[model samples]
Target: MRDVCVIGLGLIGGSLLRAAAASGRTVWGATVSEVDADAASRGGYDVTTDAEAALQRAASADAIVVIAVPLPAVENLLRQVAQHASHCLLTDVVSVKGPMLDAVRRRAPYTRYVGGHPMAGTSRSGWLAGDTMLFRDAAWVVGVEEETDLTAWAEVTRLVLDVGAHAVPLPADSHDETVARISHLPHLFAAILASVGAQGGPLAMSLAAGSFRDGTRVAGSSPDLVRAMTEGNRDALLPIVDDALGRLGAARGSLASTGGLAATINAGHEGALALEATRDAARSGVRIDLTAADAREGLVALGERGGRITGLDGAVALGEVS
Candidate 1:
């Protein structure tokens, strides 16, 4: 029987444990807190507290230790498992991969490690929030490095498939960059927008529309988790934020320019279409094949339609062909 050990009992970790158990695998879950261990045990995990004991279970059972702990805590867990789980392949569910990959390389060089991030989660936390379908249809990014072993990568891919998610192979840097734009930047924007909304009076909040709620959905996530993502991935995140701000500034300039308002309005329509196109592409697996030229064309079209491209007169002009 294959034994899998999950090091955290949070939503992602808990869900993996549940899925493994459902797959007829012998799965054990560990947590620092007794409450979580008890909850996981009740939820059908072979629960334990001893790190070495958990590592032993993982080592002997063709075990793959899924470290579901926070980003900072991951390094220690990997090191601990490396010491006791020499035979087990290790993986993690961290959103930011670059730093975690670096830490693993430095501290657990001898361990078979594959970085994993299932692009599925909710604002909810804890073992009770786990669901077997949490990862279904999600794009699971598997970060691979030069030193990664094929067998370990294959096992990690199997785990991803077992949980009903498709594996997307990406280098650590590429994974971090792509997620910074798609996931991390959006979280930061949501937090900012949510904070702005809170400053509005109660009457303003009472009249909030679906757009506001939808835009700020991720703001309800744990602040600590968001903070870690912001700081830990700051190197990759800053440029995305800069790009967002650049777009916003362009939009604002266009809105203020004479006769640019109509084109700016048309830009909003284009934006909606673009968003829909992105969603469709993701569902159809087209996003995985986007190229630099495709991205450049999209950005150029957006700028042209938004009336942000300056003409020879150095003014935002409508009907201008760039």
Candidate 2:
């Protein structure tokens, strides 16, 4: 990426600014807050509150513009970027991809737009919460559409690598569906648990343990941000919520049956193990493909090929034997 401009210097945006500056690149940042602009300036980046001005300053065919704002602000910023810096490769760090992709496609039809979501950040907001190493080793989803320019995609992936993140290429729809299950659903569950516990009175709050605190940590996230994410992707999230409710109902039914609760707990434990194993395999740069008809044979074949079977998720098994 050549000259890169980050619009909205919140946690993700601030972190991006820090990373880009560290990489010795020409980086500019824009935020509405004077405090954030000062912070970005202090961090060795040219900062401004006027996003269009920043884009205009950094405008180039090789320049990259990263929109790091929340979902609600994405469309407008995209439109501004398209109007001000049409030649630059545009991307965003919004959590929900489907809507953002559609908006980009609509507003910036001529600009090369790559939808991005850095799988990083804490329950924190604004530039003050920024960590230079926040995205280190994190999975940064790069949404690859059919019309995505390969050169622009490479520029985005290069930026991902420059920021010490792994670029996981995924279709926008797939990215939304996957994050709905793994990200949005958990946030909703955390909010629900926190809300219920809060309503249980002071005694319940006092009696809460590490599990409760840790599990509901995300509930402390910015309410507006959470609302935007959940509401923006409600279509994808609803089905996951329904599936979760169905599973919960089954577990409740099992609690009244012989060994049902134990089986449920055991299943969860196995699932956690599998997830961890798959994570490790991914970290080790290993990929495994499995067939349901001969999963045993597949495992044997993997092992023979010097690949190790680490985990199984539904019909698929993954490992890093090599």
Candidate 3:
């Protein structure tokens, strides 16, 4: 990217700014709060609360504008960006994709918009909680549609690679559905688990072990952020929530039979083992060297052949043939 502008200096945005700066990119940031702007400046980036002015100053067709704010603010920010930086490649780091994609497609019709969600974050919020390694080795989903600009998509893939993330391409609706199952549903369960534990009083809270703490950790995320994500993707999330309830009901019924509970536990163990195997396979993928253009082409060719793209070394990995 020639120039990168990140709007909203929260945890994800701050981390992006830091990573971009470290990579020697001409990075700029914009935030609604003066305090956040100050924080971004302190972190060694040119930042301002005036988003439009910042965009205008950094205006270039090669610039990539990242919308890093909450779902509620995405529409307005996108519209502003569309007006000011129409030629730039636009993307986001929000948790939900469907709503964002719709807003961008409608409001920024003239702009090249790519929907993005980095599958890496903590319960922590704000710039102080940001870390340069937040997206390192993480899965970053980039939403593509018939209207998606190829050059812009390539720019986003490069950004993902630069930030040390594995770029996975998926349609917006598919992205929403998948995240509802893996991300949103987990957050819902975590919040429920945390709430249930709270009702068990001080002794129960004190007795919480590694599993309990680890499972409920995401429940500590900002309530507003959680609420927005859950609500914005309600269409996708509701069915997943219903499926989870059905599974829970089945587990409850299984408690009455002699081997039923054990069967449920065994199923969970099998699932965990399967996940570990997948991770190990990904890590063991064969590395290959090629030029940037050839590497991109190799990734497409490998993906078409049912191979995963694990990582990049300027020359990308074609991954283990499955």
Candidate 4:
């Protein structure tokens, strides 16, 4: 197994450190957080507060470096990565991919880099909140760009698969757009829902049940972390937010005019069912030849069609499409 080095040992990063080490990969992590570093070290994991030393060690060991920081801190971190591990096989767990790739190009141009985002997490942060099984069966986007290094992509794919998550091959732009709706938008909606529920006083708080709890669950996440992703993906998220507002406006108009919410409720119900159907759809096995000339394109198309790379078999990727 390829050794792994993770920087920024928060929930996602810390979890990856634990999962990768458990998968028989020699994994070590660095975090500037003294508390988190201490916690991870006490857990019998190789962790350090000195990120620079970790990066230098990763460079020497030819380890795959996973940048596990939020979007705002990426540029600064990339500078450190450039100084230490400029030629390493690099990937990241940052939520927004487009900006992350941009930062890599500008700061660490020599690194064999792929952008990645694991579509998993909870309203938690720091090392103590990390769970080795957090990414189990989740969709982890392994970036595929026109100029992407396929060999490095495969290495990163292997690491993701090793940690018990399936890989979703996508270009950075497409990944940004998709997550803006499904991930970022939900965070915003959760914040709004929580605030609205709070305004209803003690009676509403007492009556809050499954729907309210589920809807507002992510709202409990750290505000800074939420802003880092949601605002970072705002370009893609803005249009979706507008579409949502327009739908709400129409619903309000109908409620005032016809005294009914049938259209709004029915649309939501149908959307939910459609999502469930897609999740439950039968999948057929498929293979992607990583050595082929059009391999990256094939992978992107597969992911766009709701396919997933379950595990790799040498240069041929083992996968299925729904």
Candidate 5:
């Protein structure tokens, strides 16, 4: 689109507005905050605090209105857009897909709306964290349905490219499942791990080093953001979190056996190796085709690299050789 209206003026909205502007598109930012409105205007976005005004601006310029509000506010915001911005194409930068897409479908049936989540951010929130290149090289998930128009979808993809992100098309259900496994689950575990470790006594915390710090970094995020995501996508997220806990329990139960320590160590090594492989796949822009044999080889390599192999079948069973 040649013009874009970004609602919310938070980190994601502000960043997209700036990025779109940099791409030579006419961009405007709408927020409830007067200070942020003035700042965005000064920063070169055609700024307004009024939703109607934003819609009027979008109607004249081939604008795609992006709702960058939190998950809880997305529905009402979409309603506002539908009533005032009937001519503008609609999308969002919210983290959850099921709730967002469902809300848009119910509230704005006539609008060409898409649900999107650009998987890039820092702990920082609000207008101050806006960075023009925040989405660079990141994957932006676009949720679509059978009713979605091809032309609207193509324009959404182009908007993602304009912001330096690669668009990954997914149905709302698939997007919810994938995000729950990768994003929501991690944040939940991170917060839980940090809390448990800190409660173990001050001295135990003093000894926590790189691994602990790195693992718990996401615990520092805005609790409201985390809550919104976990609550909004609870149907998909609950099962994933339960499965993770099951795996953790399995490891803990195995730890009480004669070779429990070795088994636990093997599991840790296997996990690390799997993560390395995943990162390698991402960096190479290829999807890894995992097989039972490949997993066995990875476990064998892990044991050879000083991992304690609990049994001869450990490599085959764990599938980590790193």
Candidate 6:
């Protein structure tokens, strides 16, 4: 197992550090948050607040570095990376991928990088919320761009699998667009639902049950974190937002003019059914030949069709698709 060095010891990073360590790999981490650093150190993990020092250590030991931080802080961290570990095998847990990929190109141009986003997390955050189990059974998207180093991509994919998540190879742009509709849009919906429900005052709040609580759950997440993710992916998110608004407009028009919501309700029901169908479908096994001429295309196509790499057998990718 390759040594792992994770930067940013919050929920995702701390959890990664723990998971990597548990998987029998040497692991260490750094964080800007003093509280998280102190807590992690007390928890018997090797952690520090010195980002450059940590990067330097990763450089010395040839550890795969995981950049786990907010979008706004990525550039600053990349600056340190440029100075200390510019050629390290790098990956990130940032939710948005396109901007991070672009940032790496502009800031740490020499680092062999792969962008990743684990399709897992909760409204709760911070070091204390770290859980080695958080990523189990999750679909972690690993970028496979034309310029992406296949070796680096494989290393990142292995790390994802080691942490108990299935690696879903994707292009950075495709990841941003796909997540805009699924992740970012849902956060916005949760916020909107919470806001709208709050307008009903105390009586509605008192009467709120499973539906209301579940719908507004993500609205409880930190506003700054939510803003950082959604706004950072604004370009990809805008069209999805427009589509959502259009559907909402149609629903409102139907309610006002015809006193019916069959179109919107039925569409939503079918969409939900499609989700279940996909989940319930039997998956077919596939082996991705990474040594082939069209390896990058194969990886991206597998992700496009919702396949996941369960593990790797040397350079080849062991995967399944529904």
* CA lDDT scores, all candidates in order: 0.73, 0.79, 0.79, 0.94, 0.74, 0.93
**Tens-digit lDDT track for model 4 on 239-313?**
999989999999999999999999999999999999999999999998989999889889999999989999889
> Model 4, which residues run further than 4 Å from truth?
none
Candidate 5 local lDDT, 61-100, one digit each (tens): 7589899888888777777887887767888888888778
Candidate 5 lDDT (Cα, 0 to 1): 0.74
Per residue, candidate 1 scores C-alpha lDDT tens digits across 1-322 of 3568888878898898888788777788787768778887776578776667888777777688888888878778877887878657889898888999888878877778889998899998777888988988677776556666645665676777777776666667877887898899989989988889989979769989998999999999888888877788989998999998987887788777753666656777998899787555522112211123343233234322321111111111111121
RMSD of each: 11.3, 7.4, 3.6, 0.8, 10.9, 0.7
Residue-by-residue lDDT tens digits, candidate 2, 88-185 = 78888999989998888788888778889988989999998998899887877776566665456557767787788766666778778888988899
In model 6, which runs have C-alpha deviations exceeding 4 angstroms?
Answer: none
lDDT per residue as tens, model 3, 1-322: 4678899888899899888777778888888978878877776679999999877865754578899999999889877888888777788999888888788778887777888888889899888888888889887776656666545666777788787877766677877887898889999999999999999999989999999999999999999999988899999999999988987888888886553677668888998998787666633465545444444445444444434445444434435444
TM-score of 3: 0.88
> Which stretches of candidate 1 lie above 4 Å from their native place?
259-275, 278-322
Winner on lDDT between 5 and 6 is 6
lDDT for 114 in candidate 6 is 91
Expressed as tens digits, the lDDT of each residue in 1-322 for candidate 6 is 7899999988899999999998999999999999999999999999999999999999999999999999999999999999999889999999999999999999999999999999999888999999999999999999998888788889999999999999999998899999999999999999999999999999989999999999999999989889999999999999999999999999999999999999999999999999999999999999988888998988889999989999899999999999
Model 6, total clashes: 0
Error of 5 at 86 (Å): 1.9
TM-scores for all candidates: the values are 0.82, 0.85, 0.88, 0.98, 0.82, 0.99
